[model samples]
Target: MPELLAHRADTEPDRVALVAGDEQVTFGRWHARAGAVAAGLHARGLRPGDRVALHYGTASWHDYAVACTGVLRAGLVAVPMSDRLAPAEVRHVLTHSGATAVLRSAGRPDTDLAWSATLAEIEAEAGGSVPPQPPSPRDLAQILYTSGTTGVPKGVGATHANLAHGCTLDPRRRPLAHSTHFLHAFPVGSNAGQTMLVNALNARAAALTAGTFTPGRFAKLAERYAAGTIFLVPAMAIEMLHAKVHTTHDLSAVRLVGSTAAALPPAVALQLAAAFPAATIVNYYTSTEAAPAQTSMVFDPERPGALGRPTVAADLMIAGPDGRPLPAGEVGDVWLRSPVAARSYYRDGDASAEVFRGRWVRMGDVGRLDDEGYLYLVDRDSDVVKSGAHKVSTLQIEHALHEHPLVREAAAFGVPHPVLGTAVAAAVVADGTLTAPQLRTFLLDRLAGHEVPGRVLFLDRLPRNDNGKILKRELRQLLDDDRATQ
Candidate 1:
């Protein structure tokens, strides 16, 4: 397994690792705390491979760090469920994961399931000073659940080696010391969130993690802490733009501003770039089962859809339906082979086999590689709108709609139809006075007739998950409701 803070503490004990709210923890203290937590878990009869659910927020980054570190050190698998999940969702994940124990926010019993606090308190009482056991690289470190865009949530098993490789971007260039603080607005338990945590630890950077995305509060916290770096999802960036909150903070201390978890539209990207003029704005792309594909450093208006080039060790390619690798400029399914990929989905052999092809994993995303090797997403395989004889990419149309001066966000989906078999429908968020006709006119010049959305539904905002990915299922429901009313 990857080296924990305890290892680092043995070498550089004085370095600060976490700076959350008014709390500060040195590497040595953090290591000891993790060991204590691990000992507590072990005493409660937890064993290797046992699932330990963590429902804490990012507000206390060190709490999660210690808890997750403890889980790994105890040889147990950490299952991080989103704090934003509903009670039903929480129970489903808890029962599905077979969690023997759970760690949640203090006194937030309402958020926990039946008998959650009692179990945690019992484990907490078992706490004592103890050294952590070393783990092998192949040991299962975490089991992350996907957003379940297609169906029910599936657990993706990640190894320590995978975690280690995914986190480190530039080992050759060391980052600023721990005194340099960062504000983390992303979920601490998500794949991207874990990756950010690893990056911070490797750089010895201090972090002030928040619970939710309150753009104004987050910006104010960044100013208060003089944050040196931050990682945001595109949706959060959009919120920052809408609230005009970034300007309220002293963001001058920020040197790096990274975004991922969802596609970054050209308009939102440019707004982020203009807002953080000094910081490098990186538009990243990756799936829950695979490592990040690219990191776009320079956001240009002309090449808005590009997800940039591969990070370090990822081998990305486009594969045709027949499994043959597609040449550059050909649109096909995106395939990835990386040391950072998950071993397989937990206890899901059939599901695992479907995506994991021994070494390489099929990302289930359609995209193309430019002549320069930059990857551009077309859409998800399921999101392909098949109407009569035409196979239209909803993402391409969504991109075109987003290009409209009035449109804020757009999602195109296929609705069932008797005559054409399926029809294309769109849901949009807009600010200006652009009508459906105006939108159709704008898209006419950019997209083909078959690809244009048949209906345009406007909403206050696009529904999204915790990772900021638009909920197409919800969009399809909205269309179904509209049809019933008619």
Candidate 2:
């Protein structure tokens, strides 16, 4: 893989690289800023292989992109920390990663050993070409911190070779020719967004960053720029479908739509297929540690829950209770081995040993492969609910409830029980008056006796984290509170 900044400058120097609000920044200008950031960091007593923590958000996409890529160009590890983290959490990560300095916008002073530079100042300093550095394929490129549904997030250290393999999975690699425009609406500092940024850089595709993901605003950007590709999550997809922006904006230029981070409802996928009839709507199953592993390219209207087959570059296994690979059609823990899988966590040896079993990564997800080899995810291992003598997958129950025509969203969890040890409880977002009996009746045909939810809670909306995953821990608290009152 080419140094991200150098690759773009060499292939598409004059192409537009950034579109933020009303302003347009070309690859030439973006490259210059990146070089300047490298020079600034070097001037500040930073050295090769040193770590830099970026603690900024959406407004600094261009800045983050320049700084992060520049870090790579300068032979350093780029660590993108979440802006939502508490100051103490941020401090912990900075200390854990052993980052030499924290990069932020000009005003932030609360961080320890910080460096701030306005965009204009950074751009002015790097006027000439950045000297080429010899490429090392195994060099650490980024350390991304992702906290799943439970526990503090661990930092996954990814290498350049790992990212190169992930990029090759893009089916539209041919269409994403040099100078093609790619619009990115996700927060730049996120693993997903940064992945897209790196792909665009490697392919010399022009980069366009929206300030944030607002359905209406993003559609306007795609229409305005005639972008060819977009990456989003299901919530963003639902927002676009509901906003009716496709009708108002010219989305004909979009050739590919990739979604990850959370499950994309089949109903939502169907709507997107209709909206972008000519484009490929891909639902990729992967994580920050293991980038796009399995993806479904066929958006046929007939299939219900078809998450596609594995990409040629990824090696996936479905392991059962005995730590042996299970036969196709048997749901088990999803283990992935791929070129994109991170080497290990930074400085967290125990966590690394637990997650990284040799080259394969235990994704903490339960899934099975069909006879034809398409993978179907049932639930995460941590989300399974064992009640009395029965083992239940909460996601299976939730998906069944969501299939009910009256239900908009559904979440299922296990509630403690004295006799049965645990009872299945469900919370749903629905319209019309829905009684417990009616819900039970609706689920009777779709679920077995043990899988059915005993108690149903109705809510206007389900609580979700910043990345759009539902927060079941909060739901458990609500159930506990209600039980206490009763």
Candidate 3:
């Protein structure tokens, strides 16, 4: 990563590399500041392979960027922890990773973490040059903790090669080169944020983000920067469409719009296409462990639901219950083998063995690839509903619900039933007055009789995790509580 920065500094010293609110840093200045921070960290007794935790909120994104690069420059492993974490959660990461030092912004309350120092403090100690000890391709680079929606968060250790994938600096061959700026609103300590960081080093366009993100603010940035490409999660895309931000802002400069972190709902995907008529609306599907092995699709109006074929750098397949490869259209475990080496959970041999099988990584997602090689994700393995003798996809039901104009958000899961063994149930967030019978009638026109939800409940909002994924387990608990009261 440092090598890439040095190259950019030498070639485009005066070019703008990053823009966060009122701060715009040039490549030459960013390189100098990072080098100084590296020297200061070494002076403070940081050695090669040491783990340094970076804890910062989105508001401190500029400092987070400098701190992350400085850790890499100092030949230490960077461990990024989300500031949204509670004290207990922060302690867990610090203890698990055995971080020797921490870099954070000023004004944040102190934690029980060991040897914390603010960026200002680190800069104050900056002076002497540290001898270069550039990391090899196979050396550890970063340890990213999972969101832990299912259980305790586990750390995914990435090598230099793993994080540096697709970072060729050749301007003529880079992806999305037509864009003057690559705009995103992902918070710090996210996979999407790290991906944007990589773009900052390699892409022809400057990496741009707002200090704070609202639908209106995001649109204005796009207009002000004349951003050519925009990346967002499905939830953010839905918010912008629902709020009608495009009506008030000029987004014609955008040529490509991408969604990741979760599958884009078919209804929302269509709306995005209409809103960005000049842009190519795309959806990317991948996990933190199987990154760079992404399956992406440029939205096809004819096949609005398809996730694109695997790129040249990725090898994807569907494996059945017995672990044998399944034929086309057979829903099973989705596995990916990327040019980047597969990673394991830090300090957890059991999880490493379960998830990493030789060169391939189990994606923990259930999907099928059509004969034409388009991937269609069904649902998370744990969220699939078994009703009677049939297996139903909650994602499909949710897609149907999203087709309704009144439905804003939806989640579907299995509920216990004495007669059918299990029945399909759903909770929806909507603006207008909606009833169970009315929603069922609306679904009847779009879905098969068997595919219709058995119990339809209305709510103001659906429960979501920090990363914007629906919490199906919590939704089921809500159903249980309602059943007990009745």
Q: Give me the candidate number with maximum TM-score.
A: 3
Give the alpha carbon lDDT tens digit for every residue of 243-342 in model 1: 7887677788777777878778777788788898887777777777876334454576678778887654247778998878989999899887765544
Rank by lDDT, highest first: 3, 1, 2
- Candidate 1 matches the true fold with a TM-score of 0.90
TM-score of 2: 0.89
Tens-place lDDT digits, model 3, residues 122-202: 877987757357778788889888878788889988988888887876767766688779898887767887888888888
Quickly count the clashes in candidate 3.
0
TM-score of each: 0.90, 0.89, 0.95
Model 2, range 203-317, lDDT digits (tens) per residue? 5456677766788889988888788888788778866876788999999989888887876777777778899987888887777766644455465556557677666524778
Q: Flag regions of model 1 displaced more than 4 Å.
A: 110-132, 166-173, 176-179, 292-297, 311-314, 480-486
Tell me which of candidates 1 and 2 scores higher on lDDT: 1
Residue pairs in clash, model 1: 1-136, 1-137
Report the lDDT of model 1 for residue 259.
83
Worst 10 residues of 3 by lDDT: 477-486
lDDT-wise, the better of 2 and 3 is 3
- Which model scores highest in lDDT? 3
lDDT on C-alpha atoms for all candidate structures: 0.75, 0.72, 0.84
